[model samples]
Target: MKLCVIPARGGSKRIPRKNIKEFCGQPIIAYSIQAARKTGLFDHIVVSTDDDEIAEIARSYGAETPFRRPAEISDDHTGTNAVVKHAILWFQENGTPVDLVCCIYATAPFVQEDYLQLGHDKLIQSDKSFAFSVTSFPFPIQRALKITQNGGLSAFYPEFRSTRSQDLEDAYHDAGQFYWGSAKAFLQEHELFSNQSLPILLPRHLVQDIDTPEDWIRAEYMYKAIHSSI
Candidate 1:
């Protein structure tokens, strides 16, 4: 069985009720659920959340909430891996053996079905443990600067200060949208950022991390701009 799990716990310190918060005219999670359904890629599309309202909204969007996430793993400090592993274990206990599992972020309003499909295809075709979305940094990370204790600017890499922007290697970050992993890899809690994973590169315009109020405002503007252009 192939499964898609979205871990949306209730305790979002940064943005209260963010999982169900409206974005672009609908609950943000609706976008993730819709994207998963549109791909027609999973045997089951489930939302692993402890919040009753979140579960209700998820089901309303055609996603199943068969089980409530445990309070221990639903806390703020809990990582996504634990939530996904718990979901996998639940299915295994119910006699449904999942082969491939994709964990889609509940806030990923920009997640595209094509990228989800590409991640699935690449994970299946390659020997990698996982495949997920990533996007290049707008600026070269090699010459990044930091503020000193006394408030003076200092170069993180003094040697790279002389390097031209074109000479620096490109850096990419996790797009925080979705992750496709084999059941074995997820169950083993394999690190997602290592070389064992394959990256599905997304355009910078399509990637946004909505973890703060400022980020939320920026994302809303970005979303509006992108949709307007289309």
Candidate 2:
């Protein structure tokens, strides 16, 4: 069985109630739920959250809230793997064993059904533990710099200071949109960045991390720009 679990806790530090915060017009979490629904790839689409309001909102978007997330795993320190594992365990105990699971972030407003479908197809055909969204870094990370004690800049890779940009290998980072994994992978909490994973590359324009107020504003502008063109 295929299951989609979206982890959205109530305690948000950067932007209060960010999970349900309005992006454009509707709540940001709504975008994720809508994308998951559009894919038509899950036996059950569950929103694993601790907040009552969040659960209600999730239900309105056509996701199941089978059980309230335990308080222990709903804190700031808790990771996405733990939350997905908890949901997997709950389904198993309730006699609903899932073979594949997808964890979509609540704040990922840029998530598209086509990419989610791509991740699903890739995971099903491969032995990888995960097939998650990733995007190439706009700037090469090899020439990165850091601030010194005296507030001066220094190259992180001094050896690559003179290297040509085209000569450097391209780098990519987690798009923070969605992750498709086998039930066993999530339960084992395997390293997502390891070789046992497949990456679904996305264009940089469609990816944005909305953690702070500034980030939210930037995301709003980006979202508007994309939708306007569409």
Candidate 3:
């Protein structure tokens, strides 16, 4: 059975109460919950959170919070992999065995049902054990430079210093939105990307990592523009 886990910790320092913050007309987490539900891909859509308020909102959006996340896994210092592992173990102890797990973030308000479906389909169709969304860097990374304290400019990739953008190989970065992986592989590797991992490229407009107020506003605006056209 495929399980979709949305990890929403209560303590958010950058944007206070970020998980429950309103986006468009609903809570920020509502988007991920709705997308997971709409995809109808997983056997269960669960929210692993330490905050009662966030749990309540998650339930209202049709996601189940079978257990409250432990304090250790709910703190800012906690990594997402730890939270996901805890959730998987919680379900395993309860007798509901999971085959695959999708770790969806609460702050990713731009996640769409189609994207989730695509990732799910790819994971099933390919020999890969994991798949996740990514977006290409807007600027050519070959030309990227780092400034030194002595006012010296050095190329991030020294080999690409003399290379033109069009001639350089393309690169992509993690969208920080969602990830899908086999439960067995995750338990063994403790990571989403292993040898058998695939990347799903997403459009720049649909990919935003919301960590600050400015990012939140930009994501909101992008969401509106995308949905308004649809």
Candidate 4:
């Protein structure tokens, strides 16, 4: 069986109730649940959360809340792999073992069924242990600058200062959307960013980090631009 696990903790310091906070017209978490369902990929769609409200919201949107995440793994310091491991163990304990698991982020408003399908297909077809979302950086990272303690700017790579932007190698970063992995890789807690993984590149316009309030506003604009009706 294939499983889709969404890790949504309640203690969001930046935006309280962020998992269930309305994005566009529905709760942010709804998008994730809907996307997982739309793909017809997984046998189960589970939401790992500590808050009762979050659990209820997830179930309302057609995701299973088989277990409330323990405080130890629900805290701010808990990494996503740990939560995913816990969910896998839960099913294993019930004699319903899964072969592949997909970790979908609750804050990913731009996630689509086709992208999830691509990640899963890539993971199954490739030798890599995992496949996840990524997008090219809007600007070249080689030209990055840093501010000194005294407020003076310095090039992180002085050699690149003289190079034209077009000459620099293309850079990409994790889209922070979803990850599809074999049960073995996730159970072993292997690194996801290494060469052992493949990336399902997304369009830059579909990628947005909704962390701070400013990011939230920027995401709203981006979302509208991506989906004309929204």
What TM-score against the true fold does each predicted structure earn? 0.99, 0.99, 0.94, 0.98
Candidate 1, 85-187: lDDT as tens digits: 9999999999999999999999999999999999999999999999999999999998889999999999998998888899899999999999999999999
lDDT of 2 at 182: 96
Clashes of each: 0, 0, 0, 0
lDDT of 2 by residue, 1-230 (tens): 89999999999988999999988999999999999999999899999999999999999989999999999999999999999999999999999888999999999999999999999999999989999999999999999999999999999999999999999999999999999999999998889999999999999999999888999999999999999998
lDDT of 2 at 102: 96
Q: Any residue pairs clashing in model 1, and if so which?
A: none
Which candidate, 3 or 4, has the higher TM-score?
A: 4
Candidate 2 TM-score over all chains jointly = 0.99
Q: 1-230, model 3: which lDDT tens digit per residue?
A: 89999999889898999999999999999989998999888888999998999999999989999999998777768877787788888889999898889999998988888888888889888878789989999998878899999999988888877777799888899998888887876677645555588898899988999999999998889889989999
- Positional deviation of residue 192's Cα in model 3 after best superposition, in angstroms: 3.2
| Tens-digit lDDT track of model 4 for 81-182 | 999999999999999988999999999999999999999988898888999999999999999999999999999999999899899999999999999999
lDDT of 1: 0.95
Q: Which 10 consecutive residues of model 4 have the lowest summed lDDT?
A: 221-230
Cα lDDT listed for each candidate = 0.95, 0.95, 0.88, 0.93
Superposition-based RMSD of candidate 1 using all C-alpha atoms, in angstroms? 0.7
